[model samples]
Target chain A: MAEDLVLDTAIRDWVLVPLSVVMVLIGVLRYFVSKLLRSSQTPDAKVVREGQLILRARNLRAAGGFIPVKSFRARRFYYTNEENGLLHVPKGQAQNPQAQMFSDPNMAMDMMKKNLSMIIPQSLTFAWVNFFFSGFVAAKLPFPLTPRFRSMLQNGIDLSTVDVSYVSGRSWYFLNLFGLRGLFSLILGEENAMDDTQRMMQMGGGFGVDPTKNLGAEKDGIDIIQHEWTLPKMEQRAEMVLRKLVK
Target chain B: MVGATEEARLNQLESQVDNGGGGAWEYLCLVRKLKARRSEKVLRHGIFILNSHIARSKLGGEEWTLYEQVAVAAMDCHRNDIANDCIEALSKKFPGSIRVGRLKGMLLEAKGAWPDAEKIYAQLLVDNPLDQIILKRKVAIAKAQGNLAAAVEYLNNYLETFMADHDAWRELAELYISIQMYKQAAFCYEELILSQPTVPLYHLAYADVLYTMGGLENLQAAKKYYASTINLTGGKNTRALYGICLSSVAINQLTKGRNKDEKDSADLQPLAAEALLKDYKERAPEKLPLVTAMLRNIKLVS
Candidate 1:
């Protein structure tokens, strides 16, 4: 078996530390860039009203156990009633009239802007790292890895002799990209847009699930939920608990 | 006595805070100022903004909310003059707004004029029978007055209308506990746990309830729930760690002359509990005596 390779301290000082620092700096920069690119337009009045109504309905469902059966039933009737139900949008007021993806021009524009902001910075950072710090095997992971991670962890270097544990500079950048989420949150409060994982998910179209479709799905979910009054048996349950307590 | 121009400048700063552009130091200053009961600076700033917004003909319906917040802050600082001024501005802008009316009631409550506040809430409820905000304020007034039964009644009524309000349920549960209504409190916690099973607080609370109720069956259930709580929190909860030890000891005593399966399960818990308690004690040295006392109690019981 080949002996374990010892990396020089110069690689850590020059390549590994610089690559990691640049990756974190890029994340911070991307957060500010995205913040600048973010649309200042707030949701319109009708959209806000609809969202509040849906939230109200959801709240009623989750917490209905606290109220009386009569009140629960009344609220349930108000929400699920055929006419003037909170969930039932008036004709043409539905967010997606055609129920098609990319149907709304404004929504399409929003998706495009979000995708560009997320993709542009990430691709730029990757290209910069590949061009500047590609060749050297910079660091080794503390843990063992299978051969499956060989291509992923050792991106620029094509050495057959090198073990899978030793990661190239480019791979270190990617590792820092995923690992620096907590640091970003610590520096720029929890809700900052610097999270690489979240941006990646958005890039993969996971977050682009149309809000209109979500509303439709929510409506379906609300439609199926049987509004059984939780309070009717509350007295009995309370008594049972009391009896247990007294024992 | 602040002039309109000064107010306008202050209002610009207020807008910056509202827009999430204000620095952390600005928020820290506000908190410090409020804590010191020197909210005259903030109150003056709010009035300046309101005045500017009014002068520029930009006082939209949303501006009333800003006015209400300023009024509440002013009331907190005992600056009734600024509070009344903001309230007057809000009432003038949105005369028919129930939210504004509620704010006026809240201001009365803040000033210790409980009867007047109650009257205003009562009048508002008469006008709109199902005003959830007014109902909630009434409950708050009852709580503030130390009328636990009245608070419970108002909370129960409020829950009838807005059944899904977790805050209300928690408040009602706490009130029940205060009144020695452990069963009712347990029921409330049961509802909370059902609604949010993954929440460690709910699980811990449920386990606590079961522990307090303490029959053999209740003790066993408490141990299982305590186990779940410890599992959910990744064994970090100190109370849950103690709970496991206590419940295991209780279970062991209860099943002394019982079957092997019961004894085995009961036996497994205390060992794990001791190990966890030891780990916790090492991590938090100050809690060692408390953990040691609990260990003594467990030994005495078993």
Candidate 2:
């Protein structure tokens, strides 16, 4: 009788139905989020971007090995080291009294103008796309591809008992979809599973070189993959765990 | 053989130093009086005189006071080089207060030890990545060696870290031109023009590239750009070169044409040469020897 119940419900309903639902939801979410957070069109960016203009102008002056100071409309900021050179003029003034024989003033001017428009818009767009795609794509994967945050969902680890429910609900979702209850079951298999507490402590997400710091910052590094769900709270202990993890 | 008069003046200054109120200016005047004698001993003794003057300025001595004194001496006696050397020495002794690396770099470049000087510059970049002088030297070395690819790569790397460095792009364009990578050079000039729309020479460089590429085929566009360049530089020497480039473009068309009359061929070719000379005189006055010889060759052909 137990075999019949297992064969009829477990194979027919438990695995097939939920897995299809999860995959569909993942695809829908990816489509919508990608659309919402795309970069603005180029002309819209160019029209009211004075900050970018000033920044580009400064860059241009610096590139030509000339210190460019844009004193536009009475605000003066030296883009180059001004202390060493004494040539100063009123804001928006283009003359270089101290410029030597080999100095190319025209080239300097061209660089300043180019920086004003193209470079700023393109770079800002790139930054926006990078952040948007990384977060959205991570969210929509059908299987829980990211490393689970065990410490974050630990019982009595911090303030409320909310994490207990969250962790159990996530465990249930994985079991229903892929017949694997947690991260170790899905990736490594039960025999080679890391101790639960030890797995919780793994941190720092990725290992790319940071040229400035030379050493990467570890405490909040890549391993802490965040997950969020929104099912109702349950009163019973096991039900609470299920609700917490599923959401 | 010390002069009796100079000896008296030295004794008088030493007595003033003993009295505790003889300032740097007073000592400097005494040194000037000694230097007027024009003897090797007097000149050598002036260093002592100047050092004593510096000592007197310091009862409440501001460094600026000594600096001003040196400036005046440099201008008055044309001892500017000595003053600069002393300033550089003092700056090095106190490294954190000022950057004398650029001054030193320029002096090294002037001495034509560009490769060794570039090592100091490379070290400067490693120590202080944002240092402008270090970047300048890096660009200069790359340009001097005609390593446009390396220069472009270095500048691009600098730009990645220092995104606002517009000068990097300009130098990259110049490097492309230097290496005769004409298409890349034109793109660089275009990038420069985009940043500095008002500058005419950028357009001039761009047109020059098109002319040098296949000549006459792009003559109209070259003429338009050359005209624009002349308009921008207020008819500076660059204008004369623009005219010369135009003449060359026209002559190239005539020479390569299938049917060229004898008189028309001769006139067109020599006109191109004359125009080139006028262009050279305006754009590169110092290159007269090589340019004139080439002009003579063109004259013989015509």
lDDT of 1 at A46: 47
Give per-residue CA lDDT, model 1, range A95-180, as digits (tens): 44434445668766776778776777778888888897898888988888888899999988888778889999888888888889
Cα error, residue A3 of model 1, in Å, equals: 73
Q: Give the top-scoring candidate (TM-score).
A: 1
Model number with the top lDDT? 1
The lDDT of each candidate is 0.68, 0.44
lDDT digits (tens) for residues B140-241 of candidate 1: 899999999999998997775565566788889999988988777876776666456567687678678778877986776666666666556666676776
What DockQ, between 0 and 1, does each candidate earn?
Answer: 0.02, 0.02
lDDT of 2 by residue, A139-232 (tens): 1123332234534333123423232223322233333323322543444446443332332232121122221121111111211222211101
Candidate 2 lDDT at A194 equals 36
For model 1, name the residue pairs that clash.
A63-B163, A63-B164, B7-B48
Each model's chain A TM-score: 0.71, 0.22
- Candidate 2: stretches off by over 4 Å: A1-54, A57-247, B1-93, B96-98, B101-123, B142-149, B159-170, B215-217, B233-302
